[model samples]
Target chain A: MAQNKVLLKDIANSLGVSTTLVSIVLNGKAKQYRIGEEIAQKVIDAAMTMNYSPNLIARNLRGGKTQLIGLIVTDISNPFYSAIARIVENRANELGYTVVFSSSDEELKNTKKLIEILLSKGVDGLIIVPCDGSEEIIRELHENNTPTVLIDRNFPNSDISFSCLNNYRATELATQHLIEEGFENIALIGYKTRMNHILDRIKGYEDSMKKAGFEKYIHVKKVNILNPQAEVHSALDTLIKKKNADAVIFLTNMLTVAGLYSLNEMNIKIPNDIAVVGFNRNDLFNLFYSPITFIKQPLEIIATQAVNTLIEKIKNSELEIKSMVFSEPQLIIGASSKKV
Target chain B: MAQNKVLLKDIANSLGVSTTLVSIVLNGKAKQYRIGEEIAQKVIDAAMTMNYSPNLIARNLRGGKTQLIGLIVTDISNPFYSAIARIVENRANELGYTVVFSSSDEELKNTKKLIEILLSKGVDGLIIVPCDGSEEIIRELHENNTPTVLIDRNFPNSDISFSCLNNYRATELATQHLIEEGFENIALIGYKTRMNHILDRIKGYEDSMKKAGFEKYIHVKKVNILNPQAEVHSALDTLIKKKNADAVIFLTNMLTVAGLYSLNEMNIKIPNDIAVVGFNRNDLFNLFYSPITFIKQPLEIIATQAVNTLIEKIKNSELEIKSMVFSEPQLIIGASSKKV
Candidate 1:
């Protein structure tokens, strides 16, 4: 890495100028220091020709500011997380920071390892979409005053700063929409995890069903994330065959995709056989035999707020400011959830 | 960032062990240096209690190895790129390296800037999906003997190591498949760029049409990658209306998704009205009225090979080893392109 390294002294010596003057001009303080434009231009040209690049690693060690943000997601290939990652990367870039990312694979050990790796790399802050059962590690980060912002999911009854979807109202909107379309015995397909987000979605669906006086028919099927496709298939099979469910709501984009695959395999007709609503939208939904209805989480808004909040935290770590931002999710109606 | 900094000397002082002994033990060379197990255990316990984390940035400045890989893609959120990114991330991790990613946005300026930023950060190697007109910048890197492996796209007549799909044969298989399906006027939808991948697909379609004695009916529609949706819509409109294309092949996943939307809006039926084949597979394709036939590029193979090749370059930069790996793509036959 240091084969042809160039230093400020080399540039200054070649130009017959002081290294201090070259540094001042290159650092964009020449006007304040009353340096002539011609001298600054000469310094810039000489530096470019010499291929002089500031050593950010050494600078960070001395100054303790890396200008790097670490981003951790469940999986980078997942469309929902990928979309958020792109928005965060763009917003962080605008804030004069670069983001390094890793996927936790929804494992607690991986989350801890990733955090340690990011910390060792000296990232100024972190924005994480935490996996289930990662609260203790996150709590430790909070205790150590690490500038972190949780995204998509956060722990219940914690003061950690986060920007997430209003999961409760989102599912209520979907469940209520299905009920209003004259579908009874509605079921909610969700991940069988203790994640607060999934729990909130279940509560929202159960509350909606109970409020509609269909408490006896309130059916909630939770699928393990690891075996989602097969579990979703069996769940849908039971819901349609034995449970006699006429409508179903998915709690997440992954679940929605799995449920759609299962329904398709079962030769079930959407809205006619079983009404459907999903948590997030995918482009493939548009070309579906019946376009999918979804609760479109404001991904851009959530991601941008997370970046902005994390930057604020990094800039003002001494200040005891913890903010939790929850954006509303819009229910997009399509043929899948409409009346037959 | 250094409020509660922990040092090896501090741990030594606390545990009454020499700093050299502490360093050796913490670095996992206790047995090599014949250190007693009790002293090593004490040092490890004290270090853990002190919350000691290695400073990778400083070590990298001295060692000239960051153990970090920089991945630059067209867009991180695009499924094709994201899928490749995830594979690269996992494979790089297996090789004991972490990946930091940035999107070039298909702009030469962005690609150059991203490369500069990644280099400034002192990444050990780079894996890039080059943008059109980015050949000069890539060539500069090659001349500097930088460790870089281009993925998905590469410059023609360059000795740069790359792992890409056999784009020519991929589209030829699709075009030839349509010909076998009794479609005379076969059209190809592709990006209007000097990118070798897109150009190869166009050439493949042309050659296939000419060989089939349908040269006069070879309809090629090139769209702007910047304005893909609208351009794809207009391209499909012209192909179906003016060009009288009975079958169409998409060069990429994005073009395929956009073409599906346009065809659906125009109320064109697949196979019966116009046959369809796409370049990549997406989960949403399964739910379409006629599931799309696609040439599925082996994303994992390409991404893993790029990481492996880049690491090899990094480890042996003095060696003049230039390897180009081209993976054969599979043409998945679906209901979209079938005989009536």
Candidate 2:
């Protein structure tokens, strides 16, 4: 095991060069030291073949960037977060950064602990999907100048940067679409949260309904964020049976899926019995008995923006570019929300 | 930013104690050093309140464990992998370890690069879902005495630990069920790979077909691992149109989803036109036009076992417990694969 541990000296000895020369070239200072391209390439090839990797701990202790980033999401098991993670990883890799991911489980305690752990690991920066009431933690990160970029949601009245969807517009479009289809009673299934993004969506639905002169028929059933399935089932039951809602808009991918499951269990037909529109798309949506219409967030754009913004912050700490880029949400028409 | 950088010295000063005392308590050696419990608690509480996170880089350079593990999967966007990742992360967290994850995209080049990066970061161990033909890499990891455990797939004739499903028995059960349902022409959709796990599934299907006296009717369509959807569509076309296959078995979660998409595009009916069975379950499966029948691998068990074994190896490097555990796979009957 000890012999298998290759070192700079081994590469230098094999390549017939001084260990100092090999070290400079491998550390990406070849040009700064006026080393010839041919010689540098030779050293690099030897190092690769000998499996010589620089000690990241030593480099990090020397106050060098670790080239490592941390990504904190609510849950990796959720398809939406997983898709975003894939995109973020791809983007970060292209920028020569490795991302370490953690799921907060939508708990503030978990979020705080994960942030502390990531910080202790000396990550260059963080991209977080903040849970409810994490404003203080984010403010602390901001005060410490720890490069951070929020994704999916953002805190209002904060100087933090973010890449998110215009959630308000997304639900507004869905509610209006359902109303235009002559559905008087349209209900929205959303999470019961104080988070601005979800609150914006709920407000959008209510405002759109009021604008359409359907405020009297406006109904909403909010479900618990973490343990949502059973609550979603009961919520759907109340909305459909008690309110006799003819159409419903689900405010998130998970909620949409849960609502679909409940609707299937109740044997309610889509468009014929109760029209539906979901917040985001999953490939699973395609397999639904009635392919769902959804408001699609530009995941690639949001992920790329988050990584780029965080890297920018890391590279230029004093640049003072606190930008919040919200891409427009797109509504994908499908059989579930067809004319009724 | 400078003022917010909390240190052990700052905590010590705030709590009227020496920096050495604060450091000893925070390093979890207060009892070992015979420090009073009351004083240790005071020091720890000050550190927490002041947000004093120890520099992991310095600790790691001092030959201390980083309390970090790396997870490498084929793709985090794949629900199957994402689910396992979530479970592994939770289990590792419970054991006082943090997990950093990356995707290889099923490419050997990416897998090697990820392994190198993770190693350089001083991860205590690795849990990898190896890409195809990565036997030499796994062998090298074993020889290096790296605490590594393979998940989802395993290499034969190697003394590496792994937690995986019984691939052979899983497909055998699925094929036998289809045959018993009186389907003569049963086709298998799998990946075109030399990987043993995939080969085992194919062999299981072929052996089951020959044993049922339907040798000539046995058909197998292999799709490219990276770019599979289009190939899956063409493969399904050939199996259904040219080969007149009455039933099909998908070898993996992805292959099944791709096949279902193709069948939907081809406007083929499930069960009546072509019975189908998938390898694993996704919540998306519940929404299928005809609910999918699938083989459900015990994901929680596999993930928990992988974490436990890797942690055990990390803690006891010289313990010499090289074990490979394969859990049983259960078939979930659904309408998609009913009696013919």
Per-residue accuracy of model 2 over A90-200 as CA lDDT, tens digit each: 999899888888999999999999998887778899999999999899889988888999999999889999999998899999998888878889999888899989989
Interface RMSD of 1: 1.8
The TM-scores, one per candidate, come to 0.92, 0.91
lDDT of 1 by residue, A1-340 (tens): 4346688889999999998999899899999999999999999999898989876777777777788899999999998889998999899989978889999989999999999888877889899998889998998888888898999997889989999999999989998998888987899899988999999989999999999999999989999977599999999999999999999999889999989898998999997999999878899777788999999999999999999999998898889679899899999999999887
Give the Cα lDDT of each candidate: 0.89, 0.89
Model 2 misplacement above 4 A: A1-53, B1-53
lDDT string, candidate 2, B10-92, tens digits? 88888888988988999899999999999999887887777777777777878777889999999999999999999998999
- Candidate 1 deviant stretches above 4 angstroms: A1-6, A11-53, B2-5, B8-53
lDDT value, residue A158 of candidate 1:
96
Winning candidate number (TM-score): 1
Return the lDDT, model 2, position B261.
89
Judged by lDDT against the true structure, how good is candidate 1? 0.89
Error of 1 at B291 (Å): 1.0
